[model samples]
Target: MRMRASQVLALQSHFESTFTHRLKVFLAERLPEARGALAGEEGLARLEARISVARSLGFRGERDACKYVTLSFLLGEDFHEAHWAAAALVDPRHRTPTDRAEALWNAAKQRELDEFTTESVRASD
Candidate 1:
């Protein structure tokens, strides 16, 4: 069946709204610490904006964009620009957006592990 342009637009809008809500719920569940920040109307707006920024940064897939938002919460919004390893994390050599996001995520985890190990050593000293 051929749908009119207005009908197609409405369907697209509805899908976007549903997808955004689902992403919010998933993020809230995965990031308990961010529950407060991800609550209420303002939170939805922030999430939408972050998703937009993620897309702008080459996170093409919804899941990849979600990962980007997760990274923002975990590593700070400007991590790509301000992190000590920012150059490597955002390097254009990655084959795809998924690869770049995965690399960034792994690097963030390694950074946390390194910090934790360093702190432990200092505490034992």
Candidate 2:
């Protein structure tokens, strides 16, 4: 699905909130090269395009695509290539360090998952 402009802005906000200036600059340097590769042809190309532009400018990779996707979920946002690229850069599983924003997002996401799991278990029972 095509992402709304508001959603794009929100993702940008999250991206900015999650990284430091130095990391942002480093990501900016690497982003242009990874743009197309990161944003594969899929749902919401325009929204993905906007995110690619943001990453091209200076968005840091948090780890790999999967972790980024997880982070996006944790943030209560849709997954995008920029998040994946950021995740790839940080290697979220092993050595990725999270800031306060990431921590908050993660906590919220874990709570949501826990709720879902609990509901599912209760249903099965």
Candidate 3:
């Protein structure tokens, strides 16, 4: 079934509001904490700490929650990568949306899964 342009646009808007917008806000707010966590601990301690921070934001949907969790793992890494990447990430920047979204994709791909994610994979195996 093909989606109409209107439906596609609406879905885009929904993701913008629910996942992207909230994530950017949360990242901005908790950046320092995320940076701190980079050096604090590893394994479940760091992963759970990131999830705990996400829970504090009150996101309540499957897609949003999934994004939050994945991003929780990637945020610190993404921040550092984006700092050096060709993607110019800042306000009043060219292609901010594309740049940021692409950065997240790269981050997700490059992330080293925490114990929770690894356990799920192992369980499935």
- How do the residues 29-51 of candidate 1 rate in per-residue lDDT, one tens digit apiece? 99899888889999888888888
Model 3 ranges with Cα > 4 A deviation: 1-41, 60-63, 77-125
Task: Output the number of the lDDT-best candidate.
Answer: 1
**What lDDT tens digits, residue by residue, belong to model 3 across residues 1-125?**
99999999999888745553454345546665554444433533554454554444443443434454555455552342353333333334434344443454554454444556888999999
Clashes of each: 0, 10, 0
Task: Give me candidate 2's TM-score against the actual structure.
Answer: 0.28
Ranking by lDDT: 1, 3, 2
Best by TM-score: 1
- Enumerate residue pairs that collide in model 3: none
Stretches off by above 4 angstroms in model 1 are 1-15
- Model 2 C-alpha lDDT versus the unseen true structure: 0.46
TM-score on alpha carbons, each prediction: 0.82, 0.28, 0.27
Query: Considering summed lDDT, which 10 consecutive residues are worst modelled in model 2?
Result: 64-73
Q: Please give, for residues 11-119, the per-residue lDDT of candidate 2 as tens digits.
A: 9888755443333344334555443433434423433443454344233354432233334433423332344334544444534333422543464566668889999
